[model samples]
Target: MSAKTNKGGAQAPLLGSKIKLHIEKLAIGGAGVARHEGVVVFVPQAAPNEEVLVEVSLVKKNYMEATLLEVLKPSPARREPPCPVASVCGGCNWQHITEIEQRKQKEQLVLETLKKFNPTLQFEYLPLKESPRSFRYRNRIQPKFKNNHFGFFARNSHDIVEITDCLITEEALTTKFSEVKIWAQGKNSKDLQRLEMYISEEGSVRYGLITDEDDGIGFSQVNRFQNEDLVQTALTWAGEDDYPHVLDLYAGAGNFTFPFAHKFKNAEITGVELNPKLVEKAKSKIKEKRMKYFLSDVESYMRRAVIGPEDLVVLDPPRAGASEYIMRALAAARPKRIIYISCHPVSLARDLNWIFAWSQKLGTPMKLARVQAFEMFPQTDHVETIAELRVDS
Candidate 1:
């Protein structure tokens, strides 16, 4: 355990030092935030408004990380996590906090993050859409197996936490844990094995070890129960206008492309995806000539995209969000309506800032019409948000 002194010659807390603190709130990553002697301390698995004793793990110049030793006073929202390995497994972070509180914190986190990035940003902040089932909603998961230990990795460590069941996962997959373990055992390897398990589109559980040739099922919404609402919300927000052109950026297996196609029968629908597996799957299901799926990176396709003022663009980028070039390109295109779906608040706000800035410089400002957060992955710190943008009148 090493400790360093600040430039002012003040000694910082050494590793393994015990600190009693009152948690004010949860940070973006599900860590309870508290200040000790003017230095911010982050304690994982600690609930907000709770008094807890923590042991310092790492000390930095302005902040410190600690492990929760004991909760002297638990928050009213705190509850026993349903999963047996909740404390050790890194799967669900908010299992200890009440589901209601989890949604509240996520909503607040998104709102605060957006406002923090752009203060003057204003839009209709709708209430957070709650998941129908907080637990048993996940249809896909990646579990690790090694040395007969079959489960997920521990928090911040590669050590596996064996589990007979996962609370947040759908029963369709949980019932096959024993079979998965047996399959993993037959691998006859000593190295840690990475596996992917999910219910296929045909409604059967599929499990296998990941390999270079077999990447398993590509990206898809894990929470199908709530994904319905997410898709519907995106479609409704897109409005009734039959735009001349419709583009679905980062379109994973035509989650939005198919829906948009059905809504706008005459409009030309284009889906740009980089993943060949996902593109192939999306293309296999398309039966209309007006619908096209292109296997190309979104940034590259955007460079050649010919968007019009009557075009509608729906982009659901990965967690890293879209690049500045894509944002600027969309701004310059001046699409009539843009639906930006983001899984991270910080990136969403930052991307929105770029789009609005570029629009202003181009003398075609974009307006954020409305925003809503979705509880797609309940019992986790992750959140999905959808924003409607239109050329400012």
Candidate 2:
């Protein structure tokens, strides 16, 4: 069977099928995996060791997709979801699981992904960092506006849900949501598509218009509490410097670079971002002595420019992982230290594989010094990870 099939055209496996299968693990997108007759079925909202009765949504040659219908037996890690709209809204995935259990699950996923890529790799399970505030911690949120209502879209569907308050966003944003909703209700303008809320490091709130041409949604971290933890953790790993030359790749609006400049007064910090408007904003915010901002993709800058060995590179790439070209260029540059912050652990593992591969080709392998996970999105399956690698001297 092909992966693509018209919905309702084919009758999927029935919901009451007494398939007593043990869930072995979780897929990257938070689906539970269970094998039956050598066929793997992906079930959402399921946990390891769960026995569920699911209705197959799609059947492919190798695997099947299912929506959980009945939980015959629940896993010990499972917990009641706090948000009423958790299952309906696609914003969060692991809300049904306990916070500590969620962290463990994410950590396991990271380790499993790494092991899959590098069979010989072995590392200690670093304790996952808990967010200072689990709920209402997000500093930035992109709420979609559609169907004459303002709210987040249902998971995997375009149907907009009317949300009274988002449990994960800061109280201020949730409080301001009513105003936006009222404005959207009255206005019939087609110009506004989505609203992005940004709360800066100094606790300043700003709103941005997400448009087709540009995303000034800038580099502000999503989870406010975790963002602080991540920044401090990254800076600590960056180490004390007399005057270290810092290269911030994919640096959106100087989120890290601006604050980092104050810590290292004599350091030369260069921030590179793709958005011109954000770059301009970052430049304006620069009152420090040794900081520069550039509006260019990291790959283009690395391929054409000359980098010194004394420089330290900080990369916070998108979820799709860093481009191969950029990875190769960074390997060639051989910076003293590379602090990589990623939202998607799977992509981070993939990019780390490339970095390690390229470094080995250069005859100087980089050491994976530290790996830290942050609960940026509580009540969800998503996790933010930061990995630090140093060039083996």
Candidate 3:
């Protein structure tokens, strides 16, 4: 099924004859899930249980992409998005969806991913942790400059969209946008590649200009309000039992390590990171303590890591997930408990499968103790998840 172009001259390829469909669920990427003529059609900005009139935008062999032309029936969980450019900005995917609904959806996604990866594993979904402040929670934002104005590119597109205020950014940052814009215009603004802003939990604001001259923008948590909460939650999971040794992998600027040091005063905490600049900064921030900072690839550190039964490990890997060599090292260490924090569910699932396989081979199984998802980025398809695994005695 295809539709003829109207006066607008926008050529949209229709994939199905059915114009109206009831969305049954949400795809992993935050698109509305529906079937037209037995083919899956994904419509953006359409929530689950919503009856929408979709315009077929792109058609593929197995699935179709669509634009929500009209919402015949809105879901009860829908809310008015705060950001004017929320729809255009690719940073957020669930802005229109209510916060409660967003949490629920993320929880479901985590559980489903775990089930797919480990079929025999049984664990209860932990209560979703809510960020103390949802809106204006982001401490760091890297807005790009284009055409002599400060703005951010649409998700997956280089085309810039000028932004006056960002809903996810701190109020102080949003208010200072004009100041930053003016500063950029005066300097060799064209030479400026990216603007990175960081607002601490105490409301301290710092900005970094990514350019050819200086490459050091210390590692900082993107979401301000959630950062503290996430740190506290992780510390709780890394209990202060007989285990006095803690390993913090991917420890950027000591965000987790700095706080963990204070939380577990008697424990020996080590942070391993690849960035030398970050390691130096982390060392400066964490003073007069048993904390150790190493500048090396996480996999390399893990390979040389020797852990005893009284140690607990925390792995906060990037979107690519932990490497296979690191996974094997973790298996060898056999920590009493391991905390895995990930931004990509697919990679998390893959690593979990590898861990499960290793445990099965060793005949000492590791069980998923608990799993929870946090909505760090609203109005986008991205999710931040944390999973706890304990080795069965």
Error of 1 at 144 (Å): 1.3
lDDT of 2 at 68: 85
Pick the TM-score winner.
1
Worst 10 residues of 2 by lDDT: 1-10
**lDDT of all the models against the reference?**
0.92, 0.78, 0.79
Q: Give one digit per residue, the lDDT tens place, for model 3 in 16-38.
A: 44488889877788998898767
Over the stretch 172-248, how does candidate 1's per-residue lDDT look in tens digits?
A: 99999999999999989899999999999999998888887988878999999889999999999988997999999
Model 3, poorest ten-residue lDDT window? 9-18
RMSD of each: 2.1, 4.1, 4.5
Q: In model 1, where is the ten-residue run with the lowest total lDDT?
A: 1-10
Give TM-scores for every candidate, taking all chains together and pairing residue i with residue i.
0.96, 0.89, 0.89
**Candidate rank order under lDDT:** 1, 3, 2
Q: Whole-model lDDT for model 2 versus the true structure?
A: 0.78
What residue pairs are clashing in model 2? Answer: 94-381
